[model samples]
Target: MSFKTKEKEAVGVPISESWEIDFQDDFDTFNTENWQDQRIWVNNETHCYVPDNKYGTREVSDGTLKLKVINTGAQKPCDNFDKNGVQHPDTQYVAGRITTKNKHEFIKGKWTARLRLSSNGEPSMFPAWWLLGAENNESPVQEANENVCWPLTGSGEIDIFEHHGDHQKNHYTTGAIKSLGECDKGDWWSLRKGFDVSLNEYHEYSVEWENSDLVYRVDAKEVYRNVGQGDQYPEKMFAILNFAKITDAPMKGEWVMEVAWVKHEFRK
Candidate 1:
């Protein structure tokens, strides 16, 4: 629970000189104006996202935002049914998810967050910080015809940080989902890296997007870069922060992902 102050720097470019802050949240308080609590459940995930603060789905305190996954001990039929009309049991576990859809959408820029995850590593916990095209047809937070189904168009998806607790400690994954032909057939181009980082420690995760190049970084150090050329993501994208449970493995009482702050900066 110790907080460490680290300098924020961008590789090859000085943050202060090359970038201008566009959006930021320090979690001093939950700003509903900037974020919307997402309640839909997909991805065959084990938890149902709820807006209830009592369930620890979302809470702000001590200058940090905590998105928690809680076990409710009882199962309730899910609102979203599967392809076969079978409803999944969802209430056995409830988690939190929030997005900036339609609130703060931006095109090419730098998106970053400072986070510390619960160290329990239940193998079922999945925490992620990502961005989706504002025009993505999935939720349609914007216009209808403006919808572009996933990786086929727009900014696609940029996963700045993803931690699958099932993996070895200190391992994380980052990547982009791009269209191959159609939205259903997209490529999940990604990279995995391991560090000495512990889940209990705070670390900065970021992605810098310039034209067609993307640079991923951890604490200002470069980890991976994507130089592929196909379609340049020219549309605005919104941010999503969530902690999902993807397994049926018996989980501890509760799991949490604490985020100290999030920021978006555009080139000046």
Candidate 2:
């Protein structure tokens, strides 16, 4: 689990000539100049293609997009946690989750998200910035391989910011490229210890994905970098922004995640 602390000299890869740089901008200055409103946003309605789960919503205030979810008086729904220990509850306890699904999708480029998140000291709460393949879905499959997806087949999945409430100072970040028929795969890495994450401050989580390599970073420091080669790597994917409370049953406390913005840029 190397943190990619070694600065290597610039290296290049060979790819199709059609691939070119798409977007390049500095959002640190704060301007709405080139930002495009996502095509899909959270609504009360349920759809077949989008996630209609209990705990996510999008709002607007002072020209900013605010996404939040908190547990209320609802009983926790079962079927939230899987065998791998991933929480997938049907009802939310005290958190919110959002994604740029129908609203936005990336084919291949450097994807960056600027966000602020917190466990808020509530147990079983996980906050993350992750991505999944749009083609990989749970609905009735049109074909066998047609429905197969990344984490499902161990294709290419990246978890940018994942925090457990039990540990407040550090978080876990992972990226893997599934191999050997989705069974054999790559590795994952956790961030350095003693990394203090303030509850209300903004930080940057980023992934630089190229032809056969992916790099994960936090606040400009590279934590994990995997140089992979194969078709399991994702050529395109979408982003998810969420802070969720995990409960075996619906119990309550305090947990929240605030996102400032998300940006993606590429240079060849």
Candidate 3:
């Protein structure tokens, strides 16, 4: 399938005159000042996030950001371990993960991105574009947090788009996670009709956050809406893009998630 080019105008739900573009990236090049190359591991993932281009972690070319998952036969030492307390002497896979942790953040706005994921169905390759509250304990922005744990207090998570390679060609998921009773039991909320997005074609995924509700859309079409739980996410959040290896699906070479651009507009 052919790739789609970037659009000249913003392609999302029409904004009122009061809304203004606050943050945008066409990805003409890798802007180090706006994104951090996160290398820490979590969630029992198999790949180690690295900044090296040779490992197929991050690449910017022709106005696009390519976050790739690659297999390197050589064993690379890693300091982090999974829940089982098993140390990873050497990792066979390396991938990309970048976040706007200490850069740009917003409380209520319209966040959107245009991207296409790798069509490789290896079940292990997981690609996602999501947001996390700036006050999260793991947040690189130290000033935003006041000793708060994850998914509670000032920390929340919003999954704008996520794709599992094992699913159908046009299947994906989007949802929100809210803290409940100190993160011990959080609520996982999702759309009634989960996302069915084409893997090889570019599409726009977005969330319109307001005081009253959170509306999720794909290509400007409303897919889901949450009205009552919007108050739980009062703190500002930052963006994250990554491709992780989470399963035993045998991988041959590489998997890529190409991003054309990302934008955030807020109401004045």
- Candidate 1 C-alpha lDDT tens digits along 1-268: 1121123342343444467788999999999878988766567889887765967789999999999888889986556443345556746888888998878988778899999887645688789999887877664345765567667667377788887888766767787766676755667653333444676889899988756678888898988777753135667888999999988888887888999999999886
* Candidate 3 accuracy as lDDT: 0.77
Measured against the true structure, the TM-scores of the candidates, in listed sequence, are 0.86, 0.61, 0.86
lDDT of each: 0.77, 0.49, 0.77
Which of 1 and 2 is ahead in TM-score?
1
Error of 2 at 77 (Å): 8.1
> What TM-score does candidate 1 reach?
0.86
1-268 per-residue lDDT for model 2 (tens digits): 2222122222332333222445433334323343322212111211111133233334434434444445455545433333234444344343434554444557656677666654444555556677666554432223354354435442355666666655564445456434334522334443222234564567787777656667777787887766663234544666666654443433354444656667766554
Q: Residue 16 deviation, candidate 1, in Å?
A: 10
lDDT of 3 by residue, 80-195 (tens): 54434565556888889898887888887889999997665567768989888787665243573445666785678888888877765578777677667675457765432466
Specify the poorest-scoring 10-residue window by lDDT in model 1.
1-10
lDDT, candidate 2, residue 89? 35
- Candidate 3 TM-score to native: 0.86
